[model samples]
Target chain A: MKKILLPVLILALVIQLFVPSYMIWQRYDVLKSGTEVKFDIGLFDPYDAFRGRYVSIRVEDAIATSFVRGRYGILEIDENGFAKISRVESEPPKEGLYLISSEENYFSFPHNRYYMEETLAPEAEKVIGASAEAYITVRIKNGKSVISGMYIGDVPIEEYLTE
Target chain B: MRKEKWLLDEIEKWQTEEIISPESAEILKTRYAPKKKINLLIVLFSIIGTLFVGMGVVLVGAHNLWYKLPIAARTAIGFLPLVASQVLVLYVYLKKRDSIAFCEGAAILNMAGVFSSVAIVGQIFHLPSDFTNYILLCGVLALPSMLILNAIAPLGIYFWTVLNGGLCFDSLWETPLSTALYVVGALFAIYNFRAENGRAVYVAWISVISGFILVWVTSLLEDFDVFISLFAYFALLGSASVLWERAGRSLEISGTAGTLIVMLFATYEGWWLSSIKSDITIAVLTLAFLALAIGILIKKQRVVPAALAAFAALLLRAIWALVGLNSEPFSVVFMIVANVILLAVGVYYIWAGARKVSLLYANVGMITVCTLIIMRFFDSEMSLGIRGVVFILLGIGFLGFNSYLVRMRKKAKEEK
Candidate 1:
């Protein structure tokens, strides 16, 4: 084994010198799309300079404790803990909520299903962490779904829409 | 009576085999001849020493003389230092092909000088700091050494070239590319197919540092996301497993971390329960993974632990999915039962195997089982303080066990 290790190592090293660079390129495109082109749907970072104030969001909770004045749909927290926004199939499901067919891949925005583990009352603690609250970044790209973002206070959607 | 019979049988067999022929004795004596020349070791060492001195000079010159010399002259002088070293190497190589101290070292050293020179020259000439171009130039120059010197050094240069190419040419290098490349480089570095001790270790270390650089580069590219980062971690872990198996290098830490990262990422992605979404898919994936584990184990491969851990995680994901889909009261009960059974079987096999088979592989299996158990426990609804305490205990346990096992194994080897 010792005899052949040298050549084997060299071969591996050389091969690495030529792997495709496509993965890296694609990652950059994703990063650029996220940071530079700011299209505000709901989610906001207080430090997000362009969007004057912290954007409030409509939390999609299972209990349906509170109401959004004009909600696009309900989102569900997937088992993976990501809150994907999907159309509310039935108004406030009694049992487990059935997700509305958004005709978009769950991985992409404007289609994924998100379930809220807890309710977000207005001016309440938005997150379990130091962040204000958890809200979604809704982009109408390719369809519409919430990109998970920092939490903020619950505000009337009507107020933000008018602004 | 049986022991005495066995001893009598052994004595008879020994007496029969102990008779040595005259021709056999002559052949054995000839094979052990001290007069046999091994001049290759001397030549190899000379070349290696010269290469190291050359590198030292370059480092010194870079600090001192390089600044004083005209940029053009500095560029030209790079060639001179290397050329002088190469001339000496070639002379010895030609004169004493049979004796070499460490051939790979010389090759690596040779390319190190060459690459430094080219990179420096390119810098002086105001050439585009593009990584790919630098790699291309280095690749062309070092190409001969790869073929002729039979050294691993040129490979090091080649790696730098490729890595630089990605950094300069690929915009992704500014983002995930750096992380991705670092992962790729680290995999190459730990790839030892034979003896653990050799000149290749240095190359492997270089690869590791480069990988760290890659990680740093990627950080500059974008903000860290759990999913993408985990994906990268998984890729690194998978490759690291291969390195572990091939080189027998102790990369279990990276491998374990990588696997954990990926699993966490997958859980966050909500793909953990993907198998449960379709029972057939779950069954097929499980079978596939089990098959892989069995295959590895059959071959006594080092990567069996990695495969097993992956299989266990996938199994858990499948169970979680089923529980989600079927809101029956007994769903969780069934899931728990299934995991318990599987864990029991796995532990039994690992323990039994340890007692009967080779300890190295058995130790790996045990470690893997323990890791999975720890991972699952952490995923459960435990308090933060409790979980932290558990994690600390597990870490200490692992360290202690491995340390004790290593000592035992070493002692056994010495006794043998």
Candidate 2:
């Protein structure tokens, strides 16, 4: 048992560790060189006892399209510099960034939650709530994406709340 | 005499009664001791300790105070606790290998560390919090380590996590998930059932199987799940009777008792009347399991639980069919019938337990009857003062009966 277990256990642990390491690497790579875009977001607050608290984010599409999961949606910057999907596509665009809808009634951006300190999340939610316009800066490349910063009006939510 | 139950019982009684000093008892017992007797307390503590570690890591990940650092540094440090935990586990695995408690703790902590490793990355890069995928990752990735390290508690936690996942995520794999977990749990039973003295194995197998049942319970098909549970529990009971007679009684007791309790739930109109968008799948699944349960109960000579299942199935069938015919009469009839069945079951339990001198069953029966009266009181149009008086009287009566039964049992034992 010991003879066979050592190698197999080590391999399993390695694979286990590798997944998160690979996620960090892949996400970092996307953030460093990915095409940057901003999207105005609608938000609410929910407390996840397991994962602290965060703003639950939603986005309105600039151009309405069939809400088909697994289809690619092409990105185009709107008049105010926030992103809007130009159209849904069966394949990735030849020379521009796109994000895939993972759920039927999908939010355009890949990431929805911006996890924060338990005490601070409600404050952020209220800040976003009071603001007339809010957006989040996202770095997107290929089909992978990450939320860089959440904004209240024109100011970064973190900086705004601090001020 | 080495493994004789009477000898072991005598030794235990002698130790407990202070007739022999523990060390002296141990010395005497060594000659007659069985090969292995898994310490249930240690195993139970191991499970709890492991849960604390797992929950601690998750809470700490949620606390996440270091996101302002550069992404690279933040990401690098994420694996720090995970690495440290892995190192500790590896050392325990290779060297200290001291006790089951120590090894089980180390292995389960490592499993939690795997969850933290991934979760911290999500925290680091502000990844979307999709717990379904996240926990599924944790359960699947940590599974091999659980078996390889012989950590049964991790298996419990694994099923528990997926059970929550099924509830939280509402996956397509709900039934399949339970099936798969039961396969492992049954394997654990088969492996450990006939051991010299196996409390820890019994506990582990119960956790795994009950975990499977619980996950299956949290779904849309209410009528089906209730009867299916009977079949599953009794089948488990029957198999335990054959494969491990001593442990089988424990399983049989819970299995039948559990199905009876579930039948009480089936008595509620809400369970059958839920407009849960059913199809042919529900009927087929319910019928199949009900038949299997009836067969097992007859074979095992379990008349009471089998009769309970039979009653529940017929009630379920009649309720669904009558509801289809748009009959309000059966709905009204269901209430009277449910209470009648409830009253009958309660009376049977009381009689069976009293006849057999099994105080636990009799008390359960008494409690069941009391609950029905209390429920009726609440449902009745009686004044608050009147209801309150009834409640106090009922409580006093219950206490009186309980003591009277205890005295009677003691007298019976003294006579014997």
Candidate 3:
């Protein structure tokens, strides 16, 4: 029993580690190669039991469009590097990253919120809110997107919030 | 120690009565003698101390200290607790494998380290706050260690996390991930049962909770005929009660409670008067569940009178619907009959438990009787004076019934 159990435990552990590592690695790969887009965001802080404290972000462009359930919306970036929904599409776009919304109009963007320390999350929120310009930088590749960082007028929000 | 003393006294009495030979008595005494045991105080302190230290590490990580440190140093800091916990568990496994306190303490610390590491890694990398993904990742990472360590606490935490993830993240009951999780939990439960580690109860609870969530999700997401979802919910509860009986007592208790609660919910007038089609479907399903409950009772030969009473009440309400009695007075009459039946079943359970010397059944029966009588006081439209009189009479009757059971028990013991 012991002989059989050890191998099985090792195998399960390998699989467990492989999943999260693979997901993180995939996001890393996207950030390394994908197109970067910025969107202005409104911030609020909420506490989740499992995910700790996070600053919830609302993308102005993603919220502007009326979305049908199970459909994708096309987003276009302007010269200022801010994005907005150009039109709602029934299928995935031919070349660009698109937003998919649920029946309740919740979109699964590359990043919805930034997780931080519980004590510091409110401070982050306050700093983001105080900034005249707050934008989220996302990297999109092959229809998948990963959030790189939050920026307050070109400086990472973490730098300002920490100081 | 109390049990040991009682056993010694019983052995002495048996020897005096010549129930066993002198040699047999000596063997019994030797077998019943308590063995040297680990100090429970030490075990308690060790567990508590490890938990506090683990929480401290998590708090340090939560402070975003990783941001200030160099990449190499931050990586080491993030992974240090996890590696330390692993080393501790390995040492315990190799050197103190026979010590339950050391083994469990190391295992608990390892579990905590796993969660803290995941949270730290997520925070440092600025991962999105997708609870479903986070919980699934945690469960996968923790489950293997839990199995290896035979740790029940982490296993229970993982199960509840899966449950919350499914309820919060999944929409329209189309959560294939939750379904997969339920299957995983059931498999783990079976594995624990085979291992005989007494941790199967946690897994069984997970299965029950996940099963209920699945039913709720299905009810909400599917566009079904009116009573079909209701029937399906009851069927799920009935099947769970019958199927998971071997899991543990907790599952059995939960199953019974779930059945009763759903049945009580169904007794609302809206359920019966929704439509003729709905009324007919509810009536048929009630009869089916009643038959199933009776079959279970007969096979088990256990006095689960609460389940029986619930099924019977649902059946009565269905029968009332069939009779086309949609009047307010008729509904009141049906409620009264249901309460009376509940009271009678409770009394029967109390009597049966006393006869068999089973305290759990008797206590449940007593609570049921009290609850039903109190419900009547609120549910009925009787005058205040009449209701007060009814309450007093019922209280006296309950006292008399309890005294009767006590006397009966005494007589039985004396006869023995």
Q: Would you list the C-alpha lDDT of every candidate in the order shown?
A: 0.43, 0.66, 0.64
Q: Candidate 1 chain B: minimum summed lDDT over ten consecutive residues — where? A: B122-131
Best by lDDT: 2
CAPRI quality of model 1: incorrect
**Model 2 per-residue lDDT at B63:** 78
* TM-scores for every predicted model: 0.40, 0.72, 0.71
| Per-residue accuracy of model 3 over B1-416 as CA lDDT, tens digit each | 88898999999999999999999999999999866566767766776787787777777667664465643465567667777877776677567777756866776777677667777667655676665666666675666666676655455566666666666655424566765765676576656643333345655666567666655544344433333334333433444354444454655566556644554444344444443333343345445645676676668675444455555654665566457665676765665565566667667767877888889768766876766655555753456897688789988987997899799989999999
Q: For model 2, name the residue pairs that clash.
A: none
The candidate, 1 or 2, that scores higher on lDDT is: 2
Give me candidate 3's TM-score against the actual structure: 0.71
**Lowest lDDT 10-mer window, candidate 3 chain B?**
B223-232
Backbone clashes counted, model 3: 0
Q: Which segments of candidate 2 are over 4 A away from where they belong?
A: A42-46, A60-70, A78-81, A104-108, A117-134, A150-163, B1-31, B34-50, B96-98, B171-250, B265-348, B368-416
Which candidate model has the greater lDDT, 1 or 3?
3
Model 1 lDDT, residue B338, Cα: 42
lDDT of 2 by residue, A1-163 (tens): 6798888878877887788888888888888988788887778877665556778887756543345444677888877768888777776678877886665454345667887766677888887777767888888888678878888777778677767
Which 10-residue window in model 2 chain A sums to the lowest lDDT? Answer: A61-70
The DockQ values of the predictions, listed in order, are 0.01, 0.54, 0.37
